[model samples]
Target chain A: MPGWLLTVWAAVVAMVVVFTFLTIMVMFSVWMERKVAGFIQHRVGPMRAGGFHGWAQSIADSIKLLFKEDLILIGADRKLFQIAPALVMATATAMFVVLPFAPGWQVADADLGVFLILALASVTTIGVIMAGWGSYNKWSVYGAMREAAQVASYEIPLALSLIPPILHYGTFSLATATEAQAGWGGMQWYVFSSAAPVAWLSFPLFFIAALAENKRAPFDLPEAESELVAGFHTEYTGIRFSFFFLEEYAAMFVMGAVGAALWFGGWNFPGIHLLEPGSALLQVLALFAFVAKAMALVFVMMWVRWTVPRLRIDQVMTLGYKYLTPLSMAVVLIAAFWEFGLHLIQD
Target chain B: MALPTPPREPARRHHYLGDILSTIHSTAKGMALTMRYLWRKPVTMDYPKEKPVIDQRYRGIHVLDQQLCIYCDLCAKACPVDCIEMDAVRHGKEIEWKAFTLDYQKCMFCELCVYPCPKDCFIQGTEYSMVSEDRNDFVHDLLTWKGLREEEPS
Candidate 1:
């Protein structure tokens, strides 16, 4: 085969694998969320569909949504409205391409991997804005504005907090950070180290920012259903609606992956040499481990979602700017000073 | 006696080191809770394969005892949704009814029909899975006591 053909084949294969894994992950997460919510609320979730505690509920829901009538509004901007969901879904799903599931297991291990993921992740907000504006409805426009503001504001603290970790690890590549943390000792994990207090503080700051980033609860003012009536995608139906759902799950997955990479040591496990670059089976197992860790974080996100009532839009802004942002900056300074002091003491 | 308000501590400034330590402490607390629950038995049921035990008083589908019905329209009057429609025919020489029809489509399953039946003919059953694509499936036929006697004799 020609080199171009080989490259095309590789890209196609990569797309197929990523999409399949994302679909399975979303389905499982949906089922798990329902089950968790049911247990917490003292109710039984879907039980009849495909048995085994409604294992196929998500699949059934997807099929139902697929067959439903696609409703488009009369005054809606036809082109942009249709394109908005596709943009959101595509951008959110694209993040997984650069995500390192395990050592040497990423589809594209670019040097600027983190930057690429962050840039692609921001596209989801643009999609939201477009969906809101294109709908020509007042509520959707408000929702779009709120979502844009929330995401844009939180990204400041989120990116700043992330910087300390990169400074300590000395690389932007996710795989390199994971490699650095590979050890049985607590010192190997960034969270436990004394030199980087910012990294430790960043965990919560990033978590709060991620909630805003993904539009999860407390920061979910954009889609305050009672007020905005389903937010920016209120008019969307059928597969268009499914696209929004896909984007939400994909964003959640990306947030979880980023959290693992930055704070919890991506694919690194104590006493685990199985994640070394050479063995394919080990790489696959490590990838599974990485996903498990991500899903665990996702579970925590769900727990927080269920536990807290959403803050008002202003409160959300205040929390990000007035509290989280300044706190994160202070942490960065302390971490920097601590490192400097340590160097001076040694000298 | 009026109680004096407790003296408040001076407004603590944001300390980066203190905030980092506090965040770590809180996260450790949260992780401890999560770890504790992770090993505990899941509160999930295997669902369809393992049916939950429902209470005996749980209301389900309604069943009519044809032999005991006296062609009275009490059940029809008592139904809230008006889902029940009953038709009765008296045979040539008898005061008792022969044929009867009851439409289940409008039945509210409120147990009102069951309680008001003069002959105690209506009863609620445990078979709740009565979903159907066709509306006609909801209609039911009840045999009169006379019809049962006549069929037996024949």
Candidate 2:
């Protein structure tokens, strides 16, 4: 086969894999969210759907949502309303392509992997805004505007916090960044790296900013269900609503995966360096390790969502600009100086 | 003594470091408490799968002992909602059974009809989960042997 054909073939295969992973992850996250919420609240959530604590509850819900009557509001911009969910879901799928699942498991190893993910991630807010404008509803407009501002504001801290790892690894490719961190078993993971002790702050900063970016609770003013009645998707029904729902979990997984790859050493478990290289078992272990780390980060997001009450919109803004942005910038600066001082000592 | 005045104004307080510290402390405490509860059993029952511990004295659907019941109308008269109704025929010394229906739609399950039964035959059972699509299902017949000859004195 020709190189272009091979590239096209590879791209198609990669998309299928990523899309499947994203769907399964979303289903699992949805079920996990209910279970976590139920446990925290001292109640059982979804006991009957496919039994066993309703592990298949999300599957049942997806089936229900798929068959739900698709409602398009009168006076709505039909074109934009229909396309917004597709846009959101598309961006999420695009972002997942850049994430390094294992050594060769990524859909695309773009040199600007993190940058591409970040850029694509922000485009979802546009889709959200379009959804808001398209719906022509007051509550949806509020949700859309909130999402626009929140994503815009949180993007600063989110990108800022990532600089420490980017600086340490000195690479934009997430696969390269992950490979650079695989040393000393897992001790050399940037969080515990002596080269940049301040990078520890960056992970927490990134996690919190990512929460706001994903519109998880404490930063979930966009879809404040009690106040906004499902927010930008208020006018949406059926598959379109589920598309938006799927996008939320997909975004969360991508953010968590990025966090894992950068700060937590993606696919690099304890004593992994001792394992025989270029073996099938090694690849499987690497995949498991990366997923485990990503899931842990996702778990923390769910945990925090249940733990903290939703922040007021103004409070969300204040935390993003005042606390997180400044804090992340400080971490980045301090990390740079630490590297500089280490270089001088070596000379 | 002078009447104590309730403060009219909300207290204004701002201690950034202390506030931040306390916020962290309180959030950590709350998360810890919830974490403990996560492992602990849920207070709520599964409901359908697990039947609740119903009290012995609790009034539920009426369970009438047909063998002990006399055809006296005292129980029906004591009902506040007038839900209870009974009829029987006198055949010499023995009574032939007839309709004895209780309209649960009007029956309050107040134990009023149960208490006024002369033979101590009628009482409330703990079963509460009676469901039916038909409205007439609420109107339950207390007698199992409606116009029966088996319990008749020979």
Candidate 3:
């Protein structure tokens, strides 16, 4: 086969693999969140759908959502309303392309991987805004507006926090960042790397910001179900509604992968480097490590969602603008200085 | 003692550092508590597969001891909503029990029917689950022994 054809073939294969992984991950996350929420509330969450703790509950839910009557409110912009979910899902899928799952497992090893991820992730807010606007409902409009403002504000801190990891390694490539942190078994994971306090603090900062960006609870003013019926997707039903739902789960997994790649040493295990990179055992271990870290982060998100109450819109804004922004900006500066100071000492 | 003066304007106290510290502390404490609960066994009973332990005195469904019943009209008369209907044919000295139906549509399961039975033939069993799609199912026959065991008499 020609080189170009082989590249296309590989890209196609990667897309299939990523989409499958994402679908399974999203389904699992949905079921896990319900179970976790049920456990927290002292109730048994879905036990019947798949027999064993409702293992197929999410799948059942998706099927139910798929067959629901597709409703469009009178006076709604039909075109935008229909396309909004696709846009959101598209951006979410695009994010996975840049994410490094394991060594050589990524779809594209873009040099500007982090930048591409942040950019694509932010585009989801646009889809949300469109959905809210196209719906022409007051509640949906409110949800969309809140979602827009929240993501926009949170983006600052989210982007700022990501810079610290790159500064530590001096590369925009996530692959390079992951490779740079290798050597010290698991001790060199940036979250535990006492290169400076900023290195340690960046993990929490990035995580909290990512939560807000993803519109998880405590930062979930957008779909505050009690307040806004169904939020931005109030007018959507059937497959369109499932699209939004799928996008949210996929987004969470993407953020988890990003977090793992940047701070948790994606796919790298203690003594993992000893094995040849080309060896199947090493690849398997690497994949496990990456997935384990990502799942841990996703689990933490679920835990925090069930544990913490949703924040008021004003409080969300205050947290973003007042605390997280300044804190993250300071972290970036401190991390830069730490790098500079280390360089001077070595010289 | 003189009445304590209402604090001039309620003490104005703002401890920024203390507030942040407490927020962290409370959040951590709450998360820890939830984490404990997360690992602990869930309080939920697998409702379908397991039946709950019903109390002895709980009034659920009516059960009748047909052999002991004297075909008295007391239970039918005591029913506030007049849901119970009992009919018997008298043949010489023996009263032949005919039809005894309780229209549960109006019967409140108040155990009023149980107390008024002169023969102590009627009692309430601790069985709450009765489901039927037909409207006629609501009316239960006392003679047929609804929610009762044949070996165990009242």
Candidate 4:
């Protein structure tokens, strides 16, 4: 194949793989949510349907949802209402283009990878707002406005948290950041390094911000079912609804992968040298380990969702602005001073 | 849940450096938990392939024990939905009667009728997968309960 054709083929394969993985992950997340909810309420979640703990429950749900009538609001802006879900899904999936599962495993290692992912993620809010606005419904308008404000507010803290690592690594490339953490010891992880105290603070700051970004619990103001009756996408049904669902899970995966790369050291492990000469088998194992870590993070996100009650929109904003933002700033100042003082002493 | 009002204070902007440090701290705490769970055996049980032990108190389908039942109207009256119907004819000079019908359609499976029966005859079975094409199939009669008891010499 020509070089350009080969690149295109690789991109296609990567997209397919990520898309499939995301679909499975979403199903797993649904099952997990039910199981978690059941346990919390002292009930059994889906014990029948395909047996073995109702593993096929999500599949059945998907099939049913696919056949359900697709509804468009009669008074809504038809074109935008119909296109909003696709926009959200496309933007969310596009984020995976720059995510590196392992070295040389990314679809497109763009020079502005971090910025691109962050920018694309923000597009989801636009789609959500469009859904709300175009629906021409009061509830949807309120939901879209709340969602826009919530995500926009949280993005500050989220982006700020990422800066410490970017500063330390001195690159915008996620692959480069992962490569910097490659070593044989856990202490070498960016989150543990002495050079950047800010790196430690970024972890929690980003985590809370990520929850908001994915519109998970405590920050799910946009779709507070009790208050908004399905939020911005209330009028959406059938495959359109599925698009939003898939986007949410895909966003979850992106956040988890980004978190793994920035803090835990993407594709890096203690005493693992598959990347070294003559260690192809070790390299493969390490690649799996990288994915496992990302999935593990995703699971934790699910756990948090089930554990916490949703915060009100205002409270969500307060958390991002009043609390997390200030804490993150302090950690950054301390880290900068710490590094500066060390340099002076060494000189 | 109510949507709370937005804060009056201006949004705080964190120093870019500090955000990363906190993320690391939180993730470590999170990872510690997941690592603990990963080593522990999964609580999931494969459904169709494996049957779980159900508690004895589990409420399932109801079965009626006819022989022990007396032709009393108490059970029929106690039924809230009136799904249970009983009929009896005076037999031999002793004036004994027998015949009972219970309709599952109106049955709420409340077990109220089972408890009030004077004969201590009604019982609930573990068969929960009862399905019927015709509504009439749900209606069951207990005429054979007496015959079975006679053969048993009880």
TM-score of each candidate structure, all chains considered together: 0.79, 0.94, 0.93, 0.78
Candidate 1 CAPRI assessment class? incorrect
Runs with alpha carbons beyond 4 Å of true place in candidate 1: A185-187, A194-197, A274-277, A342-347, B1-97, B101-139, B144-154
Q: Report the error of model 1 at residue A315, Å.
A: 1.0
lDDT, candidate 2, A40-155, per-residue tens = 88887889888788888999899999999999988999999999999999999999888888777777799999999889888988999999989989999999989987876799
Count of clashes in candidate 1: 1
Measured with C-alpha atoms, the lDDT of residue B78 in candidate 4 is 90
Report how closely model 4 matches the true complex, as a DockQ value.
0.12
Off by over 4 Å in 2: B1-18, B149-154
Candidate 2: C-alpha lDDT: 0.87
C-alpha lDDT values of all predictions: 0.77, 0.87, 0.85, 0.78
For every candidate, what is the interface RMSD in angstroms?
5.0, 1.2, 1.2, 6.4
Give lDDT tens digits, candidate 4, residues A1-347: 89999989987888899788778878887887777656544556787768788899999989988999988767999989988999999999898878877678787888778899889989999999999999988889988999988976788888887777777677888888888887645336787765645676678788888889998876888988989998898888899999998898889878988888878888777766524633676567667867777777787787777556787877777778777778767666766676677679879
What stretches of model 3 exceed 4 Å from their correct place?
Answer: A1-8, A194-196, B1-17, B145-154
For A304-334, candidate 3 gives per-residue lDDT tens digits of: 9988999998888888888888888988999
TM-score, cand. 3 vs. native: 0.93
Report the Cα lDDT for candidate 1. Answer: 0.77
- Local error of candidate 2 at A310, Å? 1.1
Task: Give the higher-TM-score candidate: 1 or 4.
Answer: 1
